[model samples]
Target: MQTLRSRQASIAPLGIVLATGALLTGCGLAEDIADSLDTSNSKLHHVDTGAEGKESGLLADWVPDDAEDVHVLQRTTGSERLLTFEYSGGMPSECLEIDTVGSPTQEELAAAYETDARTRDFEVTQWSTEPTMQAEWWSAGHESRTTHLCGRWWVSETEGVFHAFAAELNG
Candidate 1:
């Protein structure tokens, strides 16, 4: 009985310590980087606009471009890491593409295509969020105020993957 009690007490403290560490570090929500310029020696950059800005960034700067209302974040899964951009604008049914560099697979590209196809019907209205950006949209009569059409594009070289996740959400 004493051995069992000792084991339980030791395990309980260990579990609590691990949980505290995880919460303190925010386990997995992407790194909290900062706004940056397109320089040779740089990490990540935000365009104040999210996914749309990512597409536009490809058209102009190697990073983010003219993104006025967008937020970008970086997420990781195991050994993989991807930059996620969430965007909202004044227009609807806007479809844009982003040029990928480094290494990625065709399946990754297909995921992005699938995401776009699914979101075609939703009329994007408002997109707001920072640090970790999220896209939001609404319908005509607000039947479904928030639509899954609003999503973030996750891309990264670590995983050699690029995908758009139209998160399941409703308003």
Candidate 2:
């Protein structure tokens, strides 16, 4: 009877060890599968508002001076970055101006603008749709090779005055 009891204890430990080994192996396999299917290449999005939005510098030289409410979005995938800025109470003419000086062809600018808007899941009024004008400028403030900016404005009796902008920063 004592021998039987000893044998039972030894077998119980062996079973526990086998189960643990199997669990660890299954976890490793699952992790490998997950890594193979992973598509987000270090993508990240950041939002800033109010005073923080002004200080974020995501808009580079295009940050509006008289904006009543400011919202900024910065999205990054690997080394590439896209910045979108939205503000209220800014004049349409003033908001559309790009002060920085690098003339990337209109096509290039439009491509960057389209890419920025396409990657975003959220809507920014009409700005997410086809922009009335496309623009690109070089931001000396940044270390990127080039930064492109696109903007749209809305002035309606119901919606009030608003400005939306999108920029692409290439590393």
In model 2, the clashing pairs are: none
What digit string (tens of lDDT, one per residue) describes model 2 on residues 3-118? 98899998999998887787687867556677678775432334444345456644433345544443332233322333334456443342223333333444444443443434
Predict model 1's lDDT versus the native. Answer: 0.33
Model 2 stretches with alpha carbons more than 4 Å out: 1-51, 66-69, 78-88, 92-158, 161-171
* lDDT, residue 129, candidate 1: 14
Instruction: Give residue 20's error in model 1 in angstroms.
Output: 0.6
Candidate 1 residue runs with Cα over 4 Å from true position: 29-47, 51-65, 71-116, 119-171
Q: Give one digit per residue, the lDDT tens place, for model 1 in 1-171.
A: 579889998899999888778768886422332223223221333454443555654221222333243332222211111233332322223333333332223443343334554333543322111123222321122212112121233222112112222222234
Please give the range of 10 consecutive residues that has the lowest summed lDDT in model 1: 137-146
Q: Relative to the true structure, how large is the alpha-carbon lDDT of every model?
A: 0.33, 0.39
Where's the lowest-lDDT run of ten residues in candidate 2? 152-161
Quote each prediction's TM-score. Answer: 0.28, 0.28
